[model samples]
Target: MKIIAALVTASINKPVSTTIGLLILFMLSAMTVVAEQLPPPSATTEYSKEGADTCLQCHDQDSKFPVLAIFNSPHGNKNTKHGPFSSAGLQCETCHGAAAAHTVKRLRKGQVRAAMISFKTKDVISNDEKNQLCLACHQATTTRHWLGSVHQSNDLACTDCHQIHISDDPILNKAQQLEQCGQCHTKEKVANHSVFSHPLTSGQMGCTDCHSPHDANNNQLLVSDSVNETCYQCHAEKRGPFLWEHEPVTDNCLNCHRPHGSNQAALLTQRAPYLCQNCHNSDGHPSFSYGSDDAQGQQASAFLLGRSCANCHAKIHGSNHPSGYKFQR
Candidate 1:
């Protein structure tokens, strides 16, 4: 028994290299046991619910990705009636398609999709299909004229100037449309700011309130194209059938007036006397009148400026008098 014990002791104290090899084998066996005990891989897609988590799994800090606030928006709610999960919900995917690729790139390639998926349509598709994405909801609506509008003809994309996901976008709202429009219409802004222009600063009017955004039957997208016809809508009294008539009244209002905000009172295209003298002459004026009103009335300047022709010729439209060829009262 002693001899057997001695032999066992000797074997147990084997070479350092052999002991090290056994220790390595024991560690590998323990590792295998631990690995086998771990939970198995899940088969379900990550963040299929809400999809926000998967998207933010990468988009949390991107400055250009403005829609990230969507997660905190009313549409981001999964529990409320108006939440993204509800019937009236506004899911992130509603405007932007599934963000799977966006998330994948975030985790792997820095969140850049191979190709951009803007809402704009390209030339690759038919005209119908080219606008299919927008027409999906906007068809037969106020924007129905979009098919023939200048923007459509030029292939201008809605996303080029708008962010639809942003419900409170300044440009879309009427009160802020001017500022947005001013970004591209600097000259119009300069004209609007003239000394005698309209009250554009008071926020009572907007670009769309006067001009249509898309195509219109009117010229220059005006609510009414004909110059006089448009003015008549507002100045119905000017469409009079008085016994005396001003010849220019029959012609276009634009012949003497500037409909857009103007630098002159009454929005006149030119100051008064010169404008009136385009046809009239002072052949029947009082004996005191001498120089022509056209050249600032050197001799009768005060009379011409005050009431010379208009005061006495009140019935200038067309006098009913037996001897009034000039319609002078």
Candidate 2:
């Protein structure tokens, strides 16, 4: 009777001990999985490589990459100390990150993994990360205000407008810039082609002439503090501290003129007489209805004739003459 009782207790204790051991093993496995899922530390050291030649071996012109064309670009200039191909430069790895994992051959049957940074790839780093790589070198001069720029806030990458490998970037060329900008600014493209638009299609001016794509403190990415100030860059005569100031002209150029384009002549928002009527509603000649065809023909004809209000108020922008109060002189 004593032997049977001891055997029954031993059997029960053995199963409990086995269950506890299995529970411990499962917990340990779960902890190991959680540890493996944690992100690794960031790489601090650069890759061990000589030059762009190593990358060119696999990424040639025939392999969907125009690698050789980089030799014709500023980044490929080895003579310059500041260039990407200089002695201290990392060459392809400067912008592309390390190539070891990407270049090494694998025996797997599936597609090879992307081991380097790519601006065109959707699965790579975020747009900010990609732009940071370029800003690391381009933070000076023109890019100083890039942090809060319209383009930056919109998540537009530097690679979106620039071609790193090409000798001549299309965005930098005045003749080709409109097409590149037109990709995103479709409305502006249509406006630029209007009757009284700027000479953009004629190659006389470019979008960059008035705008700073990388950074600008003003709206519309203008190079100056205001819309009128930007227009004054080319139309300096219009920028004045005249003896007599037109309130609307001084406040904003866009109040009367359209900067992009207009169907009316001289970029006017509306034809004169009607354009003047919007502001001047005083009694007498200023408020006279020129459109009326009546027996008082002479007075109405004078207002409706060629040049209209401008026929008398010629110096409409502003005038310095003592008798120029009516803007006529």
Worst 10 residues of 2 by lDDT: 39-48
| Each prediction's whole-model lDDT (CA) | 0.57, 0.77
Question: Candidate 2's C-alpha lDDT?
Answer: 0.77
Q: For residues 1-329, what per-residue lDDT tens digits would candidate 2 score against the true structure? A: 45445445555747787756655666686788889986432122246354576678767888877678888888888886666788888887888776565655454778765446767747356787888888888878899888888899999999888998888888998888888999999988888888999888887889899898988887688889899899899988988877777888999988888777889889999987678878987456754444544526335565454536887788888889898888887
Top-scoring candidate (TM-score): 2
lDDT by residue (1-329, candidate 1, tens digit) is 45445445655969987767666666686788889986422212232355555556545555455566554544455665544545654355444444444444334545544222345454223344435555655555457887777656766665555555454556656667767777767877676776665555566666666666666775466656666666676677777665666677667677767655577766767655555666665366452334554445255555554444555665544565666656675
lDDT top scorer: 2
TM-scores for all candidates: the values are 0.60, 0.80
Off-target runs (Cα >4 Å) in candidate 1 are 1-53, 56-62, 68-90, 105-112, 119-132, 241-247, 279-303, 306-329
User: How high a TM-score does candidate 2 get?
Assistant: 0.80
